[model samples]
Structures are given as C-alpha cells and as structure tokens.
Target: MTRLNHQEKAKEFDKWISWKQEGNKDAETELIMRFLPLVTKVANRLAIGLPATVDKEDLISFGRFGLLDALQKFDHTRGLQFETYAMWRIRGAMIDGLRENDWIPRTVRDKAKKIEEAYTRLEQEKLRTPTDAEVCEYLGMTEKELQQVLYDTSLAAMVSIDEAVGEEDEQKTARHSYIVDEMTPRPESVAEAKSLKEVLSKCIDKLPEKERLVVSLFYFEELTLSEIADVMNLSPSRISQLHSKAIFRLRSALTRWKSQLL
Candidate 1:
C-alpha cells in the first residue's frame, strides 16, 4: 500500500463505510487492497528472528488468506469489532503456515519446554521464582547457552500468543486480543476489560525484576530490544532472552487463568 496522507486515509475510510453500509460492489477491490497494510504489519512483526530463507512475501500471503477468510466468515450483525478479531486470525494463520513449514526447528521448541519445566520445578522446590543462575545450574547449562536457548524459543512464545482460543465449531476469540471477559454477562462491558487488565497487572507484578523491566520497556515504552539493551547497558542478545522469559511467564499465567474459566 502506498503511504497515504490524512485526506487519503479519510477518503479510504469513507469508501469502507460505503462498502460496509451500502454493500457497494464497486468498492470491494479497494477493500481488499486496503487490507494489505494489516497483512504487511503482522508479516513484518512475525518476520523477526526468522531465517533469511523465509520470504516476507510468504508470510504476507498467509495473512492475505486469513483476511479473506475473516471477511467471508465474519458475522456483521454480531456487533463484535472486526479489526481485532482479524488481527489475531491473520497472525494465527501466518504462524500456522510457519509451523507447517517447520520454520522453527524441533530442537528449539524442546529447549524452550525444558526451560519452562525448569522454572516450574525450581519454583515448586524453592517456593519462589528461580534466579537465572539457579535455572542455569538446574538445566546444567552455561549462562551463554541459556541465553541462546531463550532467544531461539522466543519465536515459539510469539506463536503461542497467536492462537485463536475460542471453542466454537467455527470462529473463536483471538488469544492475543489479550483479555476477553468470560466472567461478565456482557463481554463488551468496560468493567470486563478493566477486570482482565487488572489480572494481567497482578501477573506482571509477580515477575522477577529484570524480566518485569524488560516487559515494561518493550511493551509499555515501545522500545525495541536493541534500544532496551542500550538503556539497560546489557547486550541485545541478553535483552532478547529476558523478553522471551518474560513472555513465557505471561503466557503460562494467562493460559492457567483461561483454563479455570473453561
């Protein structure tokens, strides 16, 4: 998609409104073209850490199919917003394609699993979050090796977040849409959003110091890993490892909470 000025964006939005409300067949091509930006955005994000052999266009193609599927199957009358749902579907589709392609090696996934196991076992044994030194010792790995493993598994953590988590025979809620309230009678209620956010806030508070800071800087402050490394005076590789560990803990917490709801 070409870079659009404010007026151009407004015009496109107007076209979308017409296509949505009036069912204008003439605007359908424009509609598909407009979706390219969304696909491109997700493709770029997921392209990180991928091997050079993996073409960016392939990821975009996967996301394009997701967008097409989303457009076809989406219930316009359900009143649920489309963009958020479609984002998850697009990411999920790209990850699905990557998995089928074996883009992430099995060894990396096994290493990540072992690290998580070490976290759980050490926590159960000591009744607290395990220190990095302790986790390294438990895994019989050097600090550098642990960092490499964490970095390798970071993409897996990302794939986990891309899951579509609903139980319907068809479309389900997007897992990465963050928190959707199952407890509330009204899923769209503002209080429902707040409650789920509070749960995540509490989980963040429970993280160890360095991991917590890494998440804060990366998510809240929107800093890249290299920028975070500069601010923290650590290597970018180390920051990537911390980011991976932080996401792993978050994913575990959210999954457990979701299971309880189920």
Candidate 2:
C-alpha cells in the first residue's frame, strides 16, 4: 500500500469533514478507515508499559469518539490542519479512558505531577536541563527519597514527545513522525543485564532473613541504610556491611553464570 504524506492526509481529512457535515454515511466509514491507524498509533504511545489487562483495542475505540468530535468541531478555513488537531483529541481520549478505568492510582498520579512541577522549576532556574542532584536539592529530598519518587512517577507516566509550542506551522505537522533509531546497545548487553538482575534476586533470596529484609528495603523499597537499620533494629554499620556482602555475592554469581553462557 502507498503511504500518504501529511499534506495528502490533511486534504483527505478535509473531504471527510465536509462529507460528515453533509450527513453522508459512506464518508464516515471512509474517515474511520483512513484514520484508524492513527488512533492505534496514539493509543500505543499512551499505553506504553501498561498492564496487559488494559486492551489496546479498547483505547482505539475510545480514540474513534475523539476523532468524531474533532471532525465536528474542525474549521478548515481557520488554517489549522485536521491531523494536528485530531492527534491531541485522540491522545486525550485514550488517556481519559485509562483514567476512567482506574489504570492509574491517585498516589502515582500525584507523584508524577510533583515530579513534573519540580522539573519545570529546576529548568526555569537553571535555564538548561538540570542534573538529578539539582532536582533533589530543589525538592529538599535525600537521594533515596528522590529515587522512590522517580520510580513511582515512572510507573504511571505515559511516554510522549515534546509538542511544538507557539509555532503555527510546526504545530500543524507531526512533531516526532520520523522513525526512532533502533541501533542501541547490543542484545548481548541487555541479556547480560537481565542475567545480572536474576542472579541478584536469587542471591538476595539466599541471605539470612534479616539481611534479606535489609536488601529489599534498600533496593526495591528505595530506603536508606539508616532507615533499614531502624526497621531491622540493627546498627547502620551492620546494615551497610550486609548490603556490601550481598552485592559481592551477586557479582560473583553473575560472573560464573556469564562464563557458562559464553
């Protein structure tokens, strides 16, 4: 199948809008068929890292409603492209659907909002992308507290590109339409990382009950050594020693497993 350029798609969209305005049934079908892939694309982008129970098809269905709304409200003579307007509508619809379905928890959403605000403030103050330390300082959070916030925020956040702001021409075009580069670190590297994580999990499981608890609190729960020590009723130095020993065991196991795989 031949791919339509943005201009061609915009022209077709205008025709669909006219047909729908005239109450033509066939035009509605044509419009849906032409833009279904676009709906799916936006849905996929919004649903990244979401659970399997949230069906992609459901998001597309919701996006169709948004497309219909956009078609009805579109003013072609105003010099704005339909695709550009419809993209936001479609994305908003999908996100609204997820929100209605309770896919995001209130706590997670709050954290994401806080992180976004903190980032915005830091960017304004620094006039550049600030380091993680800068963010921690601005938020008045210790490193461990900051990491927990980041992890929670990531759990609920949707991946989106930077939208073109304040530029009519750029706003009318797809901001990130080009294919992303796929030549990242090798598969072997990813495999190695996965192997290391698995080995570390196993090593942690083998620790004495107190040590296991300490590791879980420090890594998975993002707690500080002092916090873990208080929870386990041990000295902070003892918790530190246990953490170092656990890491050493994990590294040794991973090294052995890697040699076998080779």
Candidate 3:
C-alpha cells in the first residue's frame, strides 16, 4: 500500500470501512494490505527467542491469518480501535499456530505440569510459597534435575502464561488482558482493578530478592532470558528455572487474590 498523509489515511479508512461493511471484497483486501506491516511487527516481537527452526516468515503468515480473523470479527461501533483488538487476536493466533505445530514436546509439557503441580500443592500445604529446595523434595528431584526441568519447560512457559491461573476458562484469556484493560473499563471494574494492582504489587514485592529481580528484568525491562542470565552472572538455564519459580509464586498468589475478590 502506498503511504498516505494522516488526513488522507483517515479519509481512506472511512471509505474502506463503508465499502467493507457493504461487502466490498476489494476494500477488505486493501485494508489488509495497508495493515500488513502491523502483522509483521507483532510477528517479529513474538518470534524472539524462538528456535531457528521456527521460521519468522511462518509466524508472519500465521499472524496474517489472525489479522484476517480480527477484521472479520471486529466491531467498529463499539469504539474499540482496530489496532489494539487485532493485536490480541494476532498474537493469540500465532501462539495457537505454534501450538498446533506441536512446538512444545509432550515430555516438556509434562515436566512443566509436574513442576506447577508440585508448587501449587506444596504452597497450599505449607500455607506459603515453597522454597526451591522444598519443591525439589516434593517432586523427588535433585536441585540439578529441577533446574533441568525448568530449562526444558521454559519455552512452553514462554508460550503459555494461561497455565498460571489453573482454570481452563481463565486460561483462554491472556493474563495481561485479564488483570488489566487498556481500553475502556467500567468504573467499578477500574476500582476493583486498582485494588487488585495494589495486592499484586505487594505480592511481587514479597518475592525473594532474586526472583523479584528476575520478574522485574523480564517483564518490566523486557529482557530476554539470556540477557537476564548475563546480567545476573548465571547460566540461561538457571535464569529459566528462577523465572519458572517466580511465576509459580505469582500464579498462586493471584489465584488466591482472585478467589477473595469473588
């Protein structure tokens, strides 16, 4: 698509929206062409840290399909911006495509599950987040074995944040979308979210200093695991283990916090 000035693009968008709603297939195609760069941008962001075998082009292709889905389902009358809504669907689609391709091995998925279950169970029993040593004892694994499991499942963790919530329905929604909304939220929801944010902040602050640092660098600073490892003077695998442990703590805390809210 040719570049258009802001006013020209707005005018063109209005025309396209009218034609699209009137069932003009060409208008739809033009819209897709105009927004193709957005898909590429989202694809590149998601493609980070993926193995070389997972081609970036393939992710872009998958994201294009997602953008198409968003175009089909989007509601312009509701005041939701197309870019933001499409991003959610686009990322979800790319992740779903990866999943359909069996990007995570069954063994790795199983190990991730075991670790999450061990943490959940031990935390509930102990009435607090379990230590790495405690989790190792509960899972009958040496500290080394635990770290290996964490390393192997780290990619799966990267793909699936929903596992943190431990409910299928909740898992269907992105954790970020669930705990927060950038678009308009109802006034009551805003109040509830503010309170929840405070609770979450406290929970994060209470994490072991190392785990807190890992969470801060990864989520706040947007650092890759290897980058975090370099900063902490640890192996990437060790950082992955710490990342997994920290997630388990947050997941458990959030589950409890949500329950109380209900």
Candidate 4:
C-alpha cells in the first residue's frame, strides 16, 4: 500500500472492479476467505449479552452475508477504510438477522427500559446530555451505585443501533436509521443525507468532553474499553460508564432531530 502511487491507486481500484464487479468467482472467494475472521470478530462483539439460545455460529453466518454485501457495494476508490465501513454493514446485517429471528432477549429489553425512558425524558427536558449526578438523582440512586448500574447495563444500551428497523412492508423508524449504504441513490436523498450527517455531527459535538472522547475512541478508532481507558487515563469501568451514557444521549438527540429531518 505504501508503494502505491496515485496512478497505482486507480489501477488497484480498476482491478477490484474487474474482479468484483465483472464476476470473477476466484476473487470473490479470496475476498471472503480473507475477511472471514473479520466477520467472526464482529459476530463476537455483537454476541455479547445475547442469550445462550442464540447460537454464536448463527451470528457469524449473518456477518458473512454482511461481508459479501460490503464487497459488492463498497467503493475502494473512495479511499475509506474497508474494515471501518464493513463494521457497520456487518453489524447491521447481524442485527437484521437477529430481529428476523426475534432474538432481542426480553430480559435485556426489561433491563434497559426504565433507564432508557428516564434518560430520554431528562435529555428532552434539559435539551442537553444530562450529568451522572442528575441522572442518578432522577433515578433515585447514588453515584457509586449508578456507576456500576451503567457499566452492567451498557450492553443493553449499546446494541440499539438501528434497532427499530421495520420490514419492507412496514414504515421505518427514520430516527434509528443511520446506516445508509446505497449505490447510485437519488440526488435529493444524497442532499438529505448530508444534512442529517451535519445534525449528527452537531449532536456529537454537544456531548460532554469525556463522553465525546469515549464515543470517538470506541466507534471511530474501534478500540476496546481497556484500550480506551489506557488512552484516556481512566479505568475501564469509567470508560464503560461514559460509553453507556454517550449512547443514551445520542439516541435521545436522534429522536429529537428526526422530527425536524422528516
């Protein structure tokens, strides 16, 4: 990759197009074989907090389809990181399959419900990310107690990306629909998407300093909780607390922004 000059980059993309777009079976197989581990990795991350009844192997299988979809649709010429982009596709596919199987454990739902509702309502009323103190007071808990609860409940909160995706026959929830990967979409849709991205950017900027950094390091850098803790000079449990809070705040912002976007 370091040896690739500008023209060589174009050549590389051309090769990808010929192999992937022009039906080179061998190339497709190689691509899948190379990225099979990535699928497994994504599956493992998503499989956290899932039910024992939900087979981990099934998650890997769903992620394989995500890898295939990404290979077909990804633009190597765009100069984006394939792993980062494919993570979204892989996760979306895994979540889609889980929903199809109705694998959303009711226990997770019940665990998240009271906290999510309280957080959402507070954010709406305050029009900003609520403080841990504020949230704890609202929920009738102390700081020490709330920290453990947030870390323990983080899994329930983290898996809500596009969790409300409706079927083709049903109306979709625009708020949760952030993963917009389409080839050759309409001009209006592209403009609208850019605007929505701007809104999301502003929302992230509005998060508390620590929560924003935690979000960036976790999602954009793909760092683990312990790694992020090392980077931020905080405990892994602290990082997790911030992560859970950030997700909840972002979801609340999306709900408020969706009304205007629609």
Ranking by lDDT: 1, 3, 4, 2
lDDT of candidate 1 over 1-262, digit per residue (tens): 4566889767766676677778887776777776668888778656544445679899998999888877666665565555655666787789888899897898878887888778767766887777889999999999888887888887776676556544463645444454333332245544544555676777778898888887787656646655778889997767767777876776666655666666
Instruction: Residues 111-224, candidate 3: write the lDDT tens digits.
Output: 877887887788789877688899889989898888777766765766755332224431233554443334223554556556656766776787888888987886667576
Q: Which 10-residue window of candidate 3 scores lowest in summed lDDT?
A: 162-171
Top TM-score: which candidate number?
1
**For each candidate, what is the lDDT?**
0.71, 0.57, 0.70, 0.68
Q: Residue 139, candidate 3: how far off, in angstroms?
A: 1.3
Candidate 1 TM-score versus the reference: 0.76
TM-score of 2: 0.47
lDDT at position 113, candidate 1: 80
Which 10-residue window in model 1 sums to the lowest lDDT?
Answer: 176-185
Regions of model 2 farther than 4 Å from truth: 1-18, 49-54, 76-80, 117-130, 133-148, 155-262
lDDT of 3: 0.70
Q: List the residue pairs that clash in candidate 2.
A: none
Residue 39 accuracy (lDDT) in model 4: 85
Q: Score residue 239 of candidate 2 by CA lDDT.
A: 58
Candidates arranged by TM-score, highest first = 1, 3, 4, 2
Better of 1 and 3 by TM-score: 1
